[model samples]
Target: MVIDRRSVQRAALVVLPLVLFVAARAVSAVGDGPLQNGNFEDSPDQSQMSGSVVAGEHAISGWKTSGHIELVCSGQKQGDMVLTVPDGAQALRLGAGASIEQQISGLTQGSYYSLTFAASRTCSQDETLSVTAAPAPSGAGSPAPAQTGELPMQTVYTSIGWDSYSWAFRAEGAGLMSVVITHNCGQEEDPACGPIVDAFAIKALHDQPPDQAAADNNMLRNGGFEEGPYIPPGSPWGVLVPPVDEDPVSPLPGWKVMAYKKSVRYVDSAHFAVPRGARAVELVSGVEAALLQEVDTTVEGSWYRLEFSAGDAANGCASSSDGSSSSGMKLKAYAGTSETTVDIDFRGAGGSNRGKIEFRAAASPTRVVFVSLGYHTKSDNSGTLCGPVVDDVSLVPIPPPYARRLLL
Candidate 1:
């Protein structure tokens, strides 16, 4: 008829923590609801023609469209050819000077929100899309104040197919905000001439200390070069042969090919050996075939570390004496205005080589560039070009010594 007080205390210690953890998770899930129909899968009106959503009417249930907008479904007609939705069964076809707007609620003031989406060119050779979010109008009866601190406009070129993009902005002084996606392409006679948008999403970033957030979040997008608009015939792998020119602005999704001289091979573990992930970029085109990415830094004036793996492709195409092939590759890394170069030589074929660089961000946004500077000369007179392989690239902000001690 007696109870053990120690046993009761032990049960309480375990049960109390479990209950608290479950409650915390439930609260987090409630806050994770979608801000809009980001995938554009809901189409109440089965219409494909332009201006299907009448003026002052909601398009696709949760969005309001201005000017001309079409809810394009798969297998729909766009002028003379059939149009296919990129992300889902349905997508928004924005006409020239057209826009789609939605109001996001339940946001925390002074918190940061990240917006992401997929966009592609539909009718034109190239298209630019701008996304803006600001505090909602004060009231239905009162005039709204001037808006400030809009995110930078993003331009997407469609030749590479559908590309994914992300941007972050801070919410100031309001719990509600309005998000607008506008097509900024020039006017054309065809109604289908605009950008195709799909899979839009907005999420509030977790409340973490500045230094911790920087350390946890990667500043570079697609640093591994895994996400690209197109998947080559050797899926997850693509080859960019010599004389194939690519724009330096955006050679692939979230990457730029700065100086492509010969051929560069995109390798994936699925098709070929890779240093990390499903894909890695190989310098098969010889020297000057470089890749770079520019990303906004959350922590300015703070030291950040660049880490990556480099090695030779060992494809037996590189030229060398004694009938053996060697990959003599050099990598040049630039962080903002400061620059450094490292020579990479594979001790043997497919040897593991690692490299690291540390730099401070001098500005709010920083440019991190990697260029190939070495080429292998041919001995067999095959005229084939070969160079080093680079993969698993990452840039992470380094916390100060004092902060590290505090965390420990």
Candidate 2:
């Protein structure tokens, strides 16, 4: 075959562009950010013992310690309990006053980034972890540091083992940014009582403001009850056995518990089946306990759908049919002024069912409430206190009339 040099050059030109395009896509998928050694697999020295890294030390590549931070290896421990790393072979342990930070350059100004990581409690009690991203320190000639919004601090409990968490933030001015993860637990005699963090990752989100993103997406926070307060030992949920006259506060985040009378409210996980996530909330002790939240609709007169999973908490609690006092349990959900109720039979305990309701937003902010009715009888003669389990609650705004017409 006779080969033409000019024809060969033209074919090479066509294939070169395709190769470059694929390479560019591969680079983008890997992400260009400052987070390095996110899995904690890279250490200056891979030691089996729990090693302490002080502030200004470079024990972990691309990360700096702010106080006395410990590098915990998998299956290592400081006390009687063995510390299990959430991901990879190593994890960073933050005590009462320790923190770890990483600074990355080349961020676009006004862009959004979603930070995610896994956290687990090292001690038997609960601990709080705070993570933030801000403008890195710059020279005098550099642009002034951009104002950064505070991310909500996460309170992790012992019941939540190796759970992943996420926070979104925006870059004020795109120069260099620093991401810091700190332990905010109170001082205690045992320094090992804190949160162990691993598997850190950051991805560039849209350019929209964080508040706008949240409002446009889902108006409900912790709707799945995954972010419930710490559950104690031997209890399925965060058990609040208040006096018969005093109302106990809701242990789940972003939800309020209003009991008409003193009763027990359970932030459930680990004991019963949860419809979604690792936890669910149950109203166990009171005659009625209501879980309520005020969700911002962002647009008045807008149609929104409220969806949730409900079931009876069958933690061996005897139902009314079990020959105990009072009728069986029920779940009442109120979106704005519209209400829907589901009867929970003791025979159907531990079974999850889905329910939803649509309502028009009369006001910009709408009230969503879920109430538990009836009393639960104890299987062990501990008295009736069972309630319905509520999980996977979500509120999504429906399109306006004009938008619906356009879609049609």
Candidate 3:
């Protein structure tokens, strides 16, 4: 029998590539990065588009879109209004009931992840976006329940008319998981008027072990505001930690945003002046923007000292609309029954001042809260909200020899 060597060699070439592709897919992990076509830059071809509305399910690369999904270009006009793209030259506008989903592979089971995206309302005064994470089916009994949250777009926190939001969800029993963004509603007059969204990204979140950073005499973890969500490049506005976020899955680990209607800005040194580290929290909405943390005191009823830095972010936070420089900022720190206010008359020179608060722990886990006192906006742009920066937070119990008696 004669064996054809050419046939055998040709079959080997085809089979080998398939085997290697499967092997690579099995080991690849999707963690802490942007999704494919996250900025919606890979638009649909002319055949896949019906004017601005996407016509097919797989029209957008790396995504399955439904309903009235429109691909919008920057500066695209509707009548006399210009549509602004948050990032890149193209963005997605989901009409009423429209949704876009992408299936991600290689997510670890039961690991929490933060989803960050940029969004803005187009014509509706009251519009909302629904984010859902659905776990892929495992061979086990049943799939995990889908985690979903509604983000309101009624409030415009930034001067640019758009903001970045962070939401947390756990990766459940999955080989592949779907991350979805849906538009809940639009204007009554025009159902196509919805939200423009871009810059989708994710970051794996982890809680620090007990006393992990205690060696530096700081009882709180991530007190320097370094460990948090991933801030995309060129995002000067920073990420917003909403009040609905809890400590367990908060993008800002170890700290919870307590404001009900407003969100605290997570600024980085690349765009703003951070006090002690690359990152810090800006109390932009005055008292409406606050940070809270429950820290474990080594000894109950012990004396503890809370020290932090406060100053203007120097992102034009001091100048008034009338071209006058007025940089008076106030921060209030509260721990148990003790409270202290720190005042910094920042001149926008890019530095911070320290504030200290010593108090007695009323319980094992004492609650520490920080809030801004006055509402402020940037001097260069009055429409932009700006505030004082808080960083280098530290809390430690006072030693017995150095402890002092309180008169109050």
lDDT of each: 0.59, 0.62, 0.82
Top-down lDDT ranking: 3, 2, 1
Query: lDDT tens digits, residues 84-126, model 3?
Result: 8999899998988899998887777877788899998887777
Tens-place lDDT digits, model 2, residues 322-369? 465655567788998778887666563567778888877777678898
* TM-scores for all predictions: 0.52, 0.53, 0.89
* Of candidates 3 and 1, the better by TM-score: 3
User: Candidate 3 at residue 189, lDDT?
Assistant: 66
True-vs-predicted CA distance for residue 172, candidate 2, Å: 2.3
TM-score, model 1 to reference: 0.52
The stretch of ten residues in a row with the least summed lDDT in candidate 1 is 149-158
Question: What would the per-residue lDDT of candidate 1 be over residues 1-408, giving only the tens digit for each residue?
Answer: 999999999999999999998886654331432445776787656353335443454746678778777777777876786775666698877888788887776677766665656666666544556666677776556533323221112222123455444444556445677778888775467754777777776555543244643664766666666653233232322434122233221324456555422335555566455677666776653444566667775467677777877765555434542344444556677777777766665533555467777766778678876666655543345444445677777778787984355346
Can you tell me which runs of candidate 1 are displaced by over 4 Å? 1-34, 45-56, 139-160, 206-331, 335-338, 341-352, 357-408
- lDDT for 32 in candidate 1 is 36
lDDT at 360, model 2: 71
Model 2: pairs clashing at backbone N, Cα or C within 3 Å: 237-267, 263-286, 264-285, 264-286, 376-384, 376-385, 376-386, 377-384
Candidate 2 vs candidate 3: which has greater lDDT? 3
